[model samples]
Target: MNGNRFGRLFQVTTYGESHGEAMGVTVSGCPAGLELSEEDIQRELDRRKPGQSMITTSRGEPDEVVINSGLQDGYTTGTPIGMVIQNKDARSGKYEPYVTAPRPSHGDFTYSAKFGTRNWGGGGRSSARETVNWVAAGAIAGKILDQHGIQVKAHVNQIGDIEAPPVSFEEMLEHTEENEVRCAHPPTAEKMRERIDQYQQEGDSIGGSIYFEARGVPRGLGAPRFDSFPARLGQAMFSIPATTSVEYGLGKEAREWTGKDRNEDWEFDAEGDPIPEGNKHGGLQGGITTGQPIYGEATWHAPTSIPKQQKTVDWETGEEKEIQVVGRHDPVLPPRAVPVVEAMLSLTILDFMLLGGRINPDRLDGTAGEYDTEYHPSSPDNE
Candidate 1:
């Protein structure tokens, strides 16, 4: 519970359980005077809400976020912004069976081992349900990013065996969210949807990958070592439930390159700014942003809440048993996980931006790093 917080300057501490009365997040370290509203947070929750498609959970969370405090006159006061979303549709009874029989590939066993108790309903804090809190905080960070001309977007590039055709950043933005799966290619999305439907019929689940891109990001946002940009991004994405792998730029493909291929050449853009010709380094070099579009990919495995019985040990009896988890869950993760990828990126980047003294709350309009000249006299970034 202590580690619930994410970020150093732009901190977010999430609270509540999957079946708890209300889930929420408290955002701290956001600069004062940014325009904010519950609607801003609600819009994000809507995208992350359950039951958007047949491929997703049918449970209607309605996930309507209510601003509890920290805003007056439609602007953030720079205090802790607290928001909550009530769980009106959760059916705790359905998860009762999972209490004694922990499901495989889930946090039930580990959580109990760590806390000496666990919320059997909906995997408690271990549930991806907790991601809603992240999306809420990310929405605020996104509002800040917007003023800075930074845009964070994600796409379901692959679902199960269906892979979207290669797409450019512009193409993904233009058409990624046009479909439920959030894929850039329409044909690939259709096939992906059909695959999810097929899995639903089989009472099973599948897994796939998502790609996140952050555009217009200011250079030098990452801290050196320890909290490196890619390291921070990796930790954030890997925290999501069922996210098994994470890679940036060429990722694993970097291993196939020779010394010549590994070396990148910098070319001047229209503004005469440096841009990497070959971004096998993924818009980052020396653990910091390199003024190029930052791209990352994460692979999530199948949901454990499947109809098929799986072998597991009973926590209470220590006896082996089969558990056919009964509950509504996504047929695949990428469709719903798209927002989460964006959320983590927004939160992590904003935190780093804050630490690097990039945010200028007073300016209301301008890119993040544009305010560096207006830094506090006592601040190190000013010298």
Candidate 2:
């Protein structure tokens, strides 16, 4: 319960259960006076909402975001922004049987052990449905990063051993949303789609990884050790449900690399600023930003709530049973995780930017009541 909040200067706290009436997020420390509207948040939510494709869940939640507070004249009030998305399609009846016979490889048993009880509906608080709040808060964070010319994009790069070739950041933005699988590479996306359909038909799930990148992030946004940029990013990625591993530039592949090959040589850019000749470090040196693009991958395990018959034991009766977790569930995760990854990237980078004093914490421009500037939301009357 206490761990629901994330970030420091730009904090976000989420509430509501998966089968509850609504899922909501409260974001604090967003500097006042930037253009904001439900539309801005809704656009991002639409990407993460269920029933997006054959590969995603068929749940019918619209995921429409309602901004209930923290705005004045379509601009941030510099107060906590409160937003909620109602749960319209949750069916908790199928989960009733699992109340005592916790599903295999799920949080049901662990949550019950920890809290003595749980919502037990559609996996309740343990559901990936909780990420709706993350996408909402991340939408706000995306808006903040946009004001600073920072860009974050992600794509489904690997799906069950089908990997796409490397793509540029621009390519990711351009092609990620063009397909159901959200892979920047077209052929790979099609194959991934086919692979997902196979799993869905088999009444099972597949695992995959998302490749994310942040461009135009300034240097010196992280600290050494505990507060390293990658550390925060890893924490963010791991927070997503079912995530198995996180890796940065070169990542685990660097293990087989020699020191001479792994180390990036320094070079002077056209602007006469120092930069690494190659970005194998993933834009980090000594746990701090290096004024280069930060790129990485986060892998997710196969979703646990599949329809395949699995064995479980009822805690109360001490009886073993074969149960099939039949319900609306995704065949794969990375397709829908693209936006979530980008949102977390934006949130983490914006938090670092605020913490590093690169962006003003009180306001976008560091001045109060200045609405005529570029960062200010434009008025329809003016148009």
Best by lDDT: 2
lDDT of 2: 0.88
> Candidate 2 — which residues are off by over 4 angstroms?
366-383
lDDT comparing candidate 1 with the true structure: 0.84
TM-score of each: 0.92, 0.95
- 1-383, model 2: which lDDT tens digit per residue? 56888887788889999899999999988888889999999999999999977678899999999999999999998899999899998899989899999888899999999989889899988888999899999998998888788999999889998999999888988999899999999999899888888988888899999998988999888989988999999999999999999999899998999999898888999899988999998999899999999998999989888888899999899999999988888888888888888888899998888777777777865564423212211533111
Error of 2 at 129 (Å): 0.6
Residues 117-209, model 1: lDDT tens digits: 888888888889999999999999999988889999889999887888778888888998799989988899999889988998999999999
